[model samples]
Target: MEFCDECGSMMKAGEGEDHWVCDSCGYEKGRDPEAEEAMETTQGQEVSEIIDTSDVEDKGLPTTTVHCPECGNDRAYWYMQQIRSADESETRFFVCTECEHKWREDDH
Candidate 1:
């Protein structure tokens, strides 16, 4: 992806495939063949298998006794993530061990 030099915004493809144009500032720059090659090389690479963490029995995550609303399971794995502003508390996430149900608890 190309960025505009004048407005510092992401540039879009120009009329042809050889250049990129910035819609915000009307700036244009020649597409770099090396950058394009690198992007293609990365994009063409084989993608690894995606593992569903919730279904996995062991994820090295801490366990809690929180109630699962979906399956009525008492055991679950819990983790915290900051889903709000920096000053706010981190949200607590839980995945049921039995039914693989995911839920979150926020400190709003």
Candidate 2:
């Protein structure tokens, strides 16, 4: 009888199937052919779509009067983005254009 690597539980052989199921932890093992094919296709597409960022524009949305904290330069650009949190609250990051420094800002 095979054993589970995670919880040290006994693993049962799946009848007429390629998977091995863990009786104690309910963990499933073995690859699904359809799911594997889908993942491969997604990875191939992502590899093809990867672009060089050096030649691309920053394209960050515009904001008002973002000053650099280090150099005190007021001619910096700003961008607003949604950051995920543990409590599911959104946080914003303000990036300075001149110095490329990032700072967290509260929603106003």
All candidates' lDDT scores? Answer: 0.77, 0.59
CA lDDT, candidate 2, residue 63 = 52
- For every model shown, the clashing-pair count is 0, 0
On lDDT, the candidate that comes out on top is 1
Model 1, residue 9: displacement in angstroms?
Answer: 1.2
lDDT of 2 by residue, 1-108 (tens): 457777888877786667778988888787466764565334675466433323122664465576667777675444443344447765555555566565666633
RMSD of each: 6.8, 9.6
TM-score of each: 0.47, 0.35
Please report, as a residue range, the 10-residue window in candidate 1 with the lowest summed lDDT.
42-51
- lDDT of candidate 1 over 5-105, digit per residue (tens): 89999999988778999999899989888867776445332234223565456668888898888999999888776655779897788888888887776
Q: Which one is best on TM-score?
A: 1
